[model samples]
Target: MRVVTATNAVKDERQAGGLVVEVIETTSLGDRSYLVSDGEVAVVIDPQRDVDRVIAVAGRLGVRIALVLDTHVHNDYVSGGLELARLTGAEYGLAAADEVPFERRPLADGDVVQLSPRMRVRALATPGHTFHHLSYALEGAEGPVGVFTGGSLLFGTTGRTDLLGQQHSEELARHQHASAQKLASMLPDGAQIWPTHGFGSFCSATQATGDSATLGEQKWINPALTLAEGDFVEQTLAGLDAYPAYYAHMGVQNTTGPEPLDLREPVRAEPEELRSRLDHGEWVVDLRSRKAYVVSHLAGTVSLGLDGPMVTWLGWMIDWGAPITLLGESREEVGAAQRELARIGIDKFAGAAAGTPEELAADRSQLRSTPTATFSDLAAALAGDSDGFPAPEVVLDVRTNKEFAASHITGAVHIPLYELKDRLGEAPAGAVWVHCGSGYRATAATSLLEAAGRTVVLVDDTFDAAAAAGVPMTEPGESSSSS
Candidate 1:
């Protein structure tokens, strides 16, 4: 078997009679996912949080993705496995015993999957980092080649086994040791190791020094593998940094399927066609970063700030089934934006505004503008008294539950903007005041709540301001009406 190294170093290419592997690097999160294929059929591995890159790669290669295999349910970020499967109509597969929420082909230990005549994958249950983790060994003409070690083993360290529960500390360590030893003994010395996470990822205690490694080398230098199982378990659990607050939620979301995002459909509109569609009351989503959006953006376009948490924000703001248009810096950017949005289950792309900003601006009558609020304005609004308003009882805090729990205005109703729609019944009706950690999300929430026929007020205040204003706040463990 011949091993080929794939990294985020380049773009798509057609090689070996259309058998190609493309690595799409999502720089926003410094994450990489691979698309492996042999012309007629393809499979995606450890899909990034965004599904757009995979879709674009598949489209360019003229191949249909038949399956999506996630190395494991990730903790650092959300998974796009389900989203990719939905978009490509491919079957999603996970380790046989995985407890994730979506239906998938349960890949068992020692199960061999054929991608083509020459390319095949053998599933090896490697469950140190996570109970359901699996690594695939690639086989070709000569023998077994590289293994895709999701989080089980990296260049320098092994996947942390402390995540599941404190009680499993000993079990995880023992399992991890046995699994690593098993892999080392079974694979040839020359077999390559490809890990899902490299540096800057919290999954591995020790960051990878190189992108890839050999099984023989890892066996000698990897601390976890060299130690006794008991010591290995204890050491792995001791030095772990605090897991990110979002990990728990992300885990559950991956297991139970995240709610769908509302992405606009891709439109190829002429000036007239674009204008007619806009007149018919379709929403325009500008999927650019906050910085790019601030410098300049289209008129009548709502800024979703396609930067951090792109899919999640889009899912919360855009309408799932509405006709929409995109305003991106380039065609590739627009396409990437579309695919990422789709992964979260948003598939409506009405088309992009086809020309330069000035060209699209030729018809002034077709445009409207959304003004951004300043921090000062937001503070003033929050501090202002609402006693004279028709309904003074409604106060909505839009931050995460943890952020809200640490400290928040007492008696304020809590409805995270992301979970706002489903939890709408929890919101008090009439003249509701909404505030997030800052004003950005509050503006979006205000617009949504108002559209739902509730009178809403946008509060401009940082969390500190609320505290200083003598607004009664809730401590982390304290139960309140909001919780």
Candidate 2:
């Protein structure tokens, strides 16, 4: 794979003659997917659940989709391969070892399929990302042209092995090294690399230099090929980091096969119907500005700002398949959120409501306001603790564990936003003051806290204000950390 490091490395489009390669970038996840075609026929590799974009591209290219090839059942996001395959009369192919309830072409190592007169693909058993993953090497009559390195050997290194669970992490890491070596041995030095996960994808074991890289260059940088297997495994395993809670569900769903997406527009709900569903305990997602949401919103609604990366937080925080009602300032905003939700196959939008607060919430008592506090306000609260420890007024830092360790308000409870849904008990019993590096994640945390009926004070200000607020910051390996 070629490592294109420029921030704009991935353009809206990239092509390769009859073998067209379109980069489908999911910025929220920092992941990349692709559509490869031989002019007459096309194949989508590791696609997201939203199939409309791929379909539109196929339509514009006048190429019929002949196959939907998944490198493996993904762990991070729902697979659209099965659904998209079924929709376009294309065969869905997965490694033979990936046992699922659905019907699909079973691919094995050394299996070569001629997609067209000039296009051919060979499946190589590159199992490290997942035990059943397959990497397809493509040849377009010009000898070995490009290789889809799925989660095998990424832009700079191989895929992480720990996503399977702790019990299998080390073993898988060893296997990952071997797989990367195996692919490098077979592919030509000049082969073009097209990876499914690149840029800042969590699936990557090491920091990816870029997406557009060569097999020859990879041999120089890829530890699996350059270092001893023992050393390679150790480094890769050490580089492993945390993934999201929703990831555990993806593989299972892809193996069993996801349901076809209902592309029909979400039904618009009247204010009365919206209120009734809220009374029934259904979810209402507010896709408005953070400022607007904290000002006046339904008592139990979760606010994920539409102006930001909306879908990832929703999938991370909300339960899958649970009915959700979307509320936006306008129909346009609701539609944007709906499209974002569709990326992860969340089609259970129960209804949509768009209007001013006074109009939507006719009962003003149902309207709840979240009060905000700056870093200085929190510092003062902590200074007054008689026990010399802040408790009753807790400073809940909801940034990533890495960020929290770098610098944070002393005695602040560290809970990354993604894990809040499962680890809500770790939050303080005292009044919670939620904040992140900035207010982006704090807004998400507020919704979760409010949903669970916990009294919370939203710390919706910048993290840099900590110094001015007298909140002491510390680097890693410091005594200030409370875990």
lDDT of 2 by residue, 280-316 (tens): 8777888888999888888777888887667777777
Candidate 2 Cα outliers beyond 4 Å, as residue runs:
1-18, 199-201, 206-211, 220-227, 276-281, 319-321, 343-345, 369-392, 421-426, 429-431, 450-457, 460-470
What are the lDDT scores of the predictions, listed in order? 0.66, 0.78
Q: Model 1, 1-483: lDDT tens per residue?
A: 222324345433322333455666554443457776666678788886567767887888788898789877776557888878988799888887877666898998898888778677788999887887898886654567667787877887877776776688568777878888888988987776767765545567545666657898887888766888878776776655444334555567678776545444466666666566655646655566544543454444555645545555555444446676776656676776776655444455667853454456548654432233333433344467434433345778888655776677667887777777557677866667777886656755664564355665556456667655556667766777755
**Minimal lDDT window, size 10, model 2:** 1-10
Error of 1 at 334 (Å): 12
Task: Provide the TM-score for each candidate, comma-separated.
Answer: 0.55, 0.84
Q: Which candidate is the best by TM-score?
A: 2
| Superposed Cα deviation of residue 233, candidate 1 (Å) | 2.3
For each predicted model, how many residue pairs clash, with residues at least 3 apart or on different chains?
17, 11
